[model samples]
Target: MSLLEVKNLKKYFATQKAVDDISLSIDKGNIFGLLGPNGAGKTTLIRMITGIFYPDSGEIFFDGKKFDPVNDVGLIGYMPEERGLYKKMKIGEQTLYLAQLKGMSRKDATAKVKDWFVRFGMESWWNKKVEDLSKGMSQKLQFVTTVLHNPKLIILDEPFSGLDPVNSNLIKDEIFRLAANGSTIIFSTHRMEQVEEICNRIALVNKGQKILDGTIKQVKQDFKENLYSIGADSLPDTTGNEPYEVIGKKEQNFIVRIKPNDKPNDVLQYLLQQGVSISSFNEILPSLNDIFIKLVEGTETARQFQNIKN
Candidate 1:
């Protein structure tokens, strides 16, 4: 079931269209990735979703019902890119206060805060002030407070900002655990590798418009260019071009692009006839980063060409 849905969402700042007629849906228990480069209007769209900014035009539905900013806001746990914790407050006290603000009872908030502190190995830092902690420590403390109320929908922007590899894995594991238990997550980051690691579905926006949306596998398949990597002691030489093009080469390895209507077996047979020794051959799949750059650049190039034509 879809936990959140946005239909024809539009947000404008004077003459600037920050979010231009965007629509997306998040299913229950999904770790959906909202991805884009800097200034791609991702932040604007996110603000609208979290009720921090009202859309100039559109409808937002939560769990199949029209979402009301007044009531539905409490159902979301948002960790914005900017830190909002009190620098002067002690970790435990601040955590408890934030939980209470989310409508959790005092007893429930304290118990949950203690449990989370223990899990994060910050039990000893309970009385420590936020200003005294390192950046990574502060990040963990803020994360604990964000999720303490156990909201159904969680939005984490750059959740791994300050942590080293070890601590990053710790939080990654916790995110997986949360999804397993029925929480829907919206993960926003510029890191493509992280998105590939954790997100099942993704939406990519560029220039205030959604340029791509689908499962990771589907996106990769859609962008595949029928390229393959092959290793051989020697390759047949047409220098100019043949049934396949050797687009790249290093030592005995070659990256080949098969021409339209040409079969892989035919290429192999041609190499065999020429007595070329084949070592290894595998299809080359495009990475998410490759696809992202390709789509965004392709859009820009087309826009430039249109401008020139005018």
Candidate 2:
């Protein structure tokens, strides 16, 4: 079942359509990726969902009921791209304060904070102020505070930013654990590779609109160019009657595209007839980054501000 749903959501600014009639649903226990280029209205959409902003029109449903930003906001844990921590505050106190803000009892919040600090090897840093920690360390602390309350919906914007590979994996594992334990996550990041790796389903927003939405596998299939890579000892020159056309070559692999009326099997059969020995045959699906570029390219390099009349 969908844990969160947005229908015909619109949030407009005086000079721009920050979020224009967008709609999507995120299922329970899902790690959903919300992606877009800079100035694509993703932040605006997220703000509305998180209750920092109200929609100009349309509806939001949380856990099967109409959204009440005042009450439901407590169920969401949002870590914005820009870090928000008090530089002068002690780590332990800050974390506990944030948890309580999310409606956790003081005693419960302290217990959870201590557990997370120990788990993240941050036990020694409790009394240290935020400014004293390194960027990566601060990031880990921010993450701990965000999830300290065990929110039902955790929205992490660039959660892995500023962390080393080891630390990145640490947080990644926790994200997976959270979803496995029934927490739904909305992961927003510009790193397409990370999205491809971590998200099972994604929605791509561009210029205040949702241009793409589907599972990773389904989206790849939808945008596939039907290209294939064949690795062999040798490849014969393409004959006019061949079932496929060799489009390119890379390191002993010939990249080919099957003819309109032909299948991969037809290509293999034709290659065998020409005395070719195939070592490997694999279809080449476009990467999410490639698809992202293909769809958003040729549009404005930056979103242009416009005059909104009304």
Which residue segments of model 2 deviate by more than 4 Å?
none
| CA deviation > 4 Å runs, candidate 1 | 239-242, 269-275, 298-310
lDDT of 2 by residue, 1-310 (tens): 9999999999889999999999999999999999999999998998999999989998999999999999988899999987779999998999999999999999999999999999999999999999999999999999999898999999999999899999999999999999999999999999999999999999999999999999999999999988999999777875689888889899989998988899999989988889999999999999999999999998898999999876
Cα miss at 25, model 1 (Å)? Answer: 1.0
Model 2 TM-score, all chains together:
0.99
lDDT of 2 at 159: 97
lDDT of 1 at 152: 89
Q: What lDDT is obtained when candidate 2 is compared to the true structure?
A: 0.94
Can you give the lDDT of residue 269 in candidate 1? 80
Which candidate gets the maximum lDDT versus the true structure? 2
